[model samples]
Target: MSDLDASTPRIFLARHGETEWTKNGRYTGTTDLELTHHGIKQVKGTAIQLVGPGKLIDPGRIAHIWVSPRKRALQTFSLLFNNSSSSIGDGTTIAKTKVTITEDIAEWDYGDYEGLLVGEIRAGRKKRGLDSETAWNIWRDGCEGGESAEQVTERLDRLISEIREIQEPYMNGGNAVDVVLVAHGLILRAFAKRWLNYPIDSPLPLMFSPGAIGILSYKNHDIDEPGFYLGMALPLQD
Candidate 1:
């Protein structure tokens, strides 16, 4: 937190920890799955290292939070603040932060391909002559009976507008209005893309590992110049 500009509000993108479907590389969109024991440990570790007063994500500084409606994301958000109580490393309470469970930040709807592996999806598509021309690409072709890349872009853009509206007033120095979004892998990446005004089908190679955290903020403390942080060092805390 110290390494970055305080005047620029940050959006902490937290990808939910691993589930059985995530571990098996299955398409988990729209599926309600609980975190595995190991996944619980992953988020707990993230909480200790990145959350708390003077840490990368100070609960006290967060003004708003958007969580995916999925259970895994809900579990991750709870674990992030230690069950949403004053039980984090420094016992800083985030109860004041506005938390919204939103479908906008949820994973891409896999629709007919839900619960299927990548190879399985490809094979299915090939068998049906769906990808006979250019192969199956979620970014390009989207999921069958689910959402298209354009549809995803629309929702994500709307969410980004809401976030920017909240962050605009605070960008020039005021009460900390940082935001937090707890959700899944693919959606978070797409959110990042939209945050930077990139199209959802851009070639940017963005990957969000489970339980990982990424930061988005404005450049030069200007809300109009949104950008993502490549890396940030945690502040030293007593």
Candidate 2:
């Protein structure tokens, strides 16, 4: 981890809400699934707790928003910022932060394994004379015909570096150098680990629930000691 000033920069990692694959533990990459009705309601609660004035995440403080190009993630972003249903809240009250759709944040490209659960993929590999027991950790053994851990790390490193650049000018300018990222589970986890300079294959035991929110920031606002802060309001109250 790097050391940072009192307010170096903040990157908020938000996993999209539940989709059919989300609830099924499938490896969802290019296959997009709309949020479940329950998932919509889930994120609405997150918005109320985190987006409004005097809340954990002041909408005005956000400098840039990056979301995956996937429809699921876009849906998640919309529900959080511009919810149209009465159950979610009014979009008019939310700040209209410009959102960028980026492929860097998309889920791991599972390739031939897309939409297959871990067990199913492993079983298939074993039946094909391949080691599936422990040789199939996505971080180490990337999906066939898809991205490798090295590829994912390289992409995330580039994205993280650019994000740093985006926030550089805003440092100490009284402008919040806060960037929000809405993406899928695997890639988002990899991004968070990469932010801390952790090896992509490090068995870090990190887990992300559907619609989970994770925050990364420099230690004391300095760009050096990057660390994860358990500050995001995934949910506040009813």
lDDT of 1 by residue, 1-238 (tens): 3554477789999999999998989999998999999998889889878887777887778889999999999999999976533364566776743889899999999999999999999998888877767878898889989999999999999999999899899887687889999999999999999999988888899888889999999898898899989987777767
lDDT for model 1 comes to: 0.87
Q: Residue 12, candidate 2: how far off, in angstroms?
A: 1.0
Quote model 2's TM-score.
Answer: 0.86
Model 1 collision count: 0
User: How much lDDT does each candidate structure score?
Assistant: 0.87, 0.77
Give candidates' CA RMSD values in order. Answer: 1.8, 4.4
Model 2 C-alpha lDDT per residue in residues 1-238, reported as the tens digit of each score: 3222234567878888888878878889999789999888777767756655444454656777888999999998887766533224333343444577889899999999998989998888888888845556888888898999999998899999888887766555467667889998889989988989999999888888887678887765566667898653332334
Residue pairs in steric clash, candidate 1? none
